[model samples]
Target: MFDVAGLWHGFQIAATPVNLMWGLIGCALGTAVGVLPGLGPAATIALLLPISMKMGSPVTAIILMSGIFYGAMYGGSTTSILLKIPGEAASVVTCIDGYEMAKSGRAGAALGVAAIGSFIAGTIGLIGLTMMAPPLAEAALKFGPSEYFSLTVLGLLLATYLTGESALKGLTMAIVGLILGCMGLDPLSGAVRFDFGVADLQSNLDFVTLAMGLFGVGEILYSLEKSGTASILTTRIENVFPKLADLTRSGWSMVRGSVIGFLVGILPGGGAVLSSLISYAVEKKASKHPEEFGHGAIEGVAGPESANNAAASSSFIPLLTLGIPGNASTAMIFAALLIHGITPGPFLLKEHADVFWGVVASMYIGNVMLLILNLPLIGIWVQLLRVPYSFLAPLIMVLTLVGVYSVNNNVFDIWVMLVMGVFGYVARKLKFDLGPLLLAFVLGPIMERSLRQALLMSNGDGSVFFTRPISGSLMAIAIAFVLYNLWAARKKNRAARAVASSEAAK
Candidate 1:
């Protein structure tokens, strides 16, 4: 069971002057990058990982990192509303309704609603974190490799489905990612695989290098190929708060989004991006005014904004409790913990309660800070957007290169990053989503290792996954999801055929 007293003690520690200062710095920096398109929290955290290790103790460092995570979630809404560009991937859905709202001169209301919704969602997610993480960790203590493997499978399926594209494309990208994950030395055997005789290849791919290139560089390439810049705002900005009617209309949407996002965020492959998309979809499906979705529906802005923030907060659960990186940003956080000589796992609550609870408590404080920071500074953010894209592009490119090279001091890593950038661009042009690719790449090695260990323990009995109670349930769920999708596809096709036949008869 979770101890509320322990979490309260954590707030006391996080409130210290130094930790609070670190939190403020992180929020400020995170907001700056997040308001700029293509710069995300993962790259920022990866860039700061080396610095965090040396800045202070692990507790203070993680407080800073967690601050950046939630801050980016809040800040991502800025460019989404004003420029119709997603400052982060999770903000993609926001661009639809948010930009529409801005076009109608309700940009401030959209921004205000996003901030308020995010604050509420973050608070809800934090309460869930305080109550749920410990119990989940305790339950996870009983899990073996088979159970972990099955859970990952289920997570991958759910992630693929929620991306709002054809599942076939998502699954294909995942297969490609799995192949990529097989690179580097065989952990169990002494032999190297897929090295192609290159000395640097023997070490396998660096997660940071791959993440930065595929997301950062790939985005730049894709965006550059598209002609035209974001529509610059020239109108006078006013009204920084939502009207009472706006609040009343979006209240339920916010509540539902918060709940859905937190649940999805607990799964291994889930994150803010998926949460936002699904929240937007649900709003469209359930709305009486469904036709208003892309034309500046407040439900569109409220649901996704709330969902992404909640999802961002809840995505930390698997990382803190199970020692698994739930998504890309958490993967970077996992790397940071390893740098600080702390292993996050089942014992995390028992052994490193301070670090665990302190980080959680700081999120509460950080969310408040983000609300305060974003509301008053909407004008500043809009003005910052006036800086030419030509100027920002070069600066971003230089920063990406410097951030990758600073930690490892390896030239090979630079080459790897560029190669991934090209690969990512090609894949995107082919209509493939990078979410599955990256998630699969990160989880592939873990899945392989888990299966091997489980087989070893079971002495080659392949049924171990099906025989185990928890693992079996998870595997069943995955199978059912596939079947359900197939059934739905057939039904949709049949409906199309019936409509065509009716037209011919007429």
Candidate 2:
């Protein structure tokens, strides 16, 4: 049975004037970051982390951060639609048809649909979280070290699926990230694995520093490599609202996207980026006029924007209930919970009902706040797209440095950021996606810890992995995925060779 009493209490806390104001501030700040190129939800959250700590309560602080997280997902699509510049990886799909819609003078309609879809999807995903989280938490309590090890393996496999091009490349990058994660202290034995006699690396690499380096600084370097400077769209703002017909067309698309996105977000290591891409692909395949996909499809903007927001909202479930963050933003949310002396996991709902439900209740309010904030301000966001790249690029670099250095007040972190930036630029030029690498880095430690624990528990018996039903099933699925990917690659290569042979014969 649903706990109506708990929900009412949550509303009492979340509806307070102070919390509401904090939520609004987060939403505004998140939107600003989303509108700016080279800034992402992770970077924004990290930059504001210190400031959030100054707030009185953990619940209040997290409510603000969560608002920023989901709001950024909503705001990211604005740039993709208006200027074809994706604010984040998740919004890339939006650029295909969203910019085309803008080109056809339907920018208003696109923005309106995206905002409305996000609002609806966010609300629905929250409801799912509320309904599903308690039972999930209960199940998590039964998880042993072996189960957790298997779960982490599943997460890495899912990440490979999300890597865009080649599974082999994704696997290689994931292994590299795992090795990087091993550069410091060995948790079980307390022995250094690959520190190479460096005292600074004794504590291991910081997640914030690596994330900032790879995502923030690396993105800036890649952006600088483009031939032309940042070109903001100068299209006149006309028709700032969607037509009734447009709404009718996009309503079901939003609903479908919301369902799909929420499910994907529940999976470990899968988040808004994957949800948005899947939503766009699904909508395009299902549309009556598939050819319209690359040229102003309303469904394109509506579906992906909705999916990304839903994914962002649903990602909180694992973080709050399982003490496992589904994505980077959720990882920060976990950090906030830890700062509050509130450890999240199976006991979280029992021990901190107020905090859990309060955060949930605040999500409802945050969605309403985002809708109010974004709809009328679409023009302002569009105008921001006009800012020149020369000015914006420098600001991004400075912010990246500040954010990285502020994490632990360490200069070494800054150097790490620069090196990662160079690596990111080179990887981008080589057509390798960064999504898998980032996922691998985030999950690496957890995977390593779990594997070691599982091994110890199994008395060093490798067969123990296949002894439990859940672990065995998960391993079976991973094996199937690998085999399927190999077969697909072989088929693709054969087809290419046949085409080349035909051309030669001709």
Candidate 3:
């Protein structure tokens, strides 16, 4: 049975006036950041880390930040549906049918379905969080260094699979991220690995600086490369509510998406982006009119949008329960918890029940709040797209600069942002996925630490990784995935060659 008393206590804390206010502010700021072309949830949370530290209790700070996290997931779709540009990786699927819907003059319906579906998925995710978290936390207590290392390996393999186009490219980017992660002081020896004697290099590349530069500044530069200005100028606001037929069509799609998203979200380093892609693929495969997917299919818009948001919400489980962050935003949230002197792990449920349950409760409230706020204000958000690029672009640039500078009060971060922006543009042009890179950056340290610990525990034996049952199983799965992926690639190449020969014969 659910613990009613614990939930009641959580509601009491989350309902406080100050906490509620922070949640609202976070939601609004997150929405604004998401609406902007370049900024993402990770950048926004990292930028605000300094401010969050100076503010209220850990629970309240997290409440505020969580609002921003989930809100951005919701808000990213708005721009994607309105413009062809995706606000973030998680919103990429939204652009497929969402923009098509806008072009077909059903933008209102698309937006409506997105908001409603997100709300429903968010609620379901919270329910899963509330019920499943404690048991998972208990289970995580048994995870040793070997198990953790295996998990990280699995996570990297999953990243490779999720990366579009080529697994080799994803592996290359992940290796690059791991190398970049090694620039700082070694955790075990306290020795510098890649520092060139510069004081900033001594502390290593800041995650905030790297992320802000790559996603924020880099995105802006890419946008500048496009010829001519673009703006959201459409004034046709139809009914904000989904029609009865539209609801009937998308109801099951939403359920399927939520289930898949929640399960994927539980995996370390898998979150909204992977969930959205998987949901879209599943929806397309199951659709009665699969051909309609890229041409304004309602299921395309509804399914992926819901999946992304639900995945965003459920990702908190590992972070709060096992002290393992599944994504960059969750990593930032973990940083916030550490800053506030809270160590999240197996004991958190018993020791910090208020914080855990309060966060869960707030998510429920936040979902309801988002629906109420977004549905009626869809017109306002659409109008926001009408702002001239000349004005909006520079403002985004300035915000990016300020956000980078705010972290550690360092001007070096601004320079890093500029370099990263250029690199990001190049990567985008080369069709490299940034998702794998970001995940690698976040998981690199954990993987390193876990591997070292496991080796030490086994007297420096390399076979320790395969000695444990759980660890061995995970590694076996990862190996299978790699082999399968390679086999599939070869098969695809052969098929393509056969097609070319047939064309030549014709």
Q: Indicate which candidate wins on TM-score.
A: 2
List the candidate numbers ranked by lDDT, top first. Answer: 1, 3, 2
Each model's total of backbone clashes:
0, 0, 1
User: What is the descending TM-score order?
Assistant: 2, 3, 1
The regions of model 2 sitting more than 4 angstroms off are: 53-56, 227-230, 332-344
Q: Give Cα distance to truth, residue 449, candidate 1, Å.
A: 2.0
Clash pairs detected, candidate 1: none
Off by over 4 Å in 3: 99-105, 233-235, 284-296, 339-352
List, residue by residue over 1-506, the lDDT tens digit for candidate 3: 46778778888988898888888888877776677666678767766766776786888999988999999888888889888777777889999999998898898899899989999898888888888888888887888999888887887777657645678888888888888888879888899988777777888677767776666676677777765655673747687798999989998889988988898988765789889999999999999999999999999988998898889889988888877677768877876776677877777887889889888888888888788778897766666665666676687678778866765788877887788879877997898866567667767787899999999989999888887888998899888988988899999999999999999999
| Predicted candidate 1 versus true structure: per-residue lDDT over 273-348, tens digit per residue | 8889899999999899999999999999999999999998888888888777767678777767766878777888
Model 2 whole-model lDDT (C-alpha atoms): 0.81
For each candidate in turn, the TM-score is 0.90, 0.91, 0.90
lDDT of 3: 0.81
User: Which structure is stronger by TM-score: 1 or 2?
Assistant: 2
What lDDT does model 1 reach? 0.84
What are the lDDT scores of the predictions, listed in order? 0.84, 0.81, 0.81
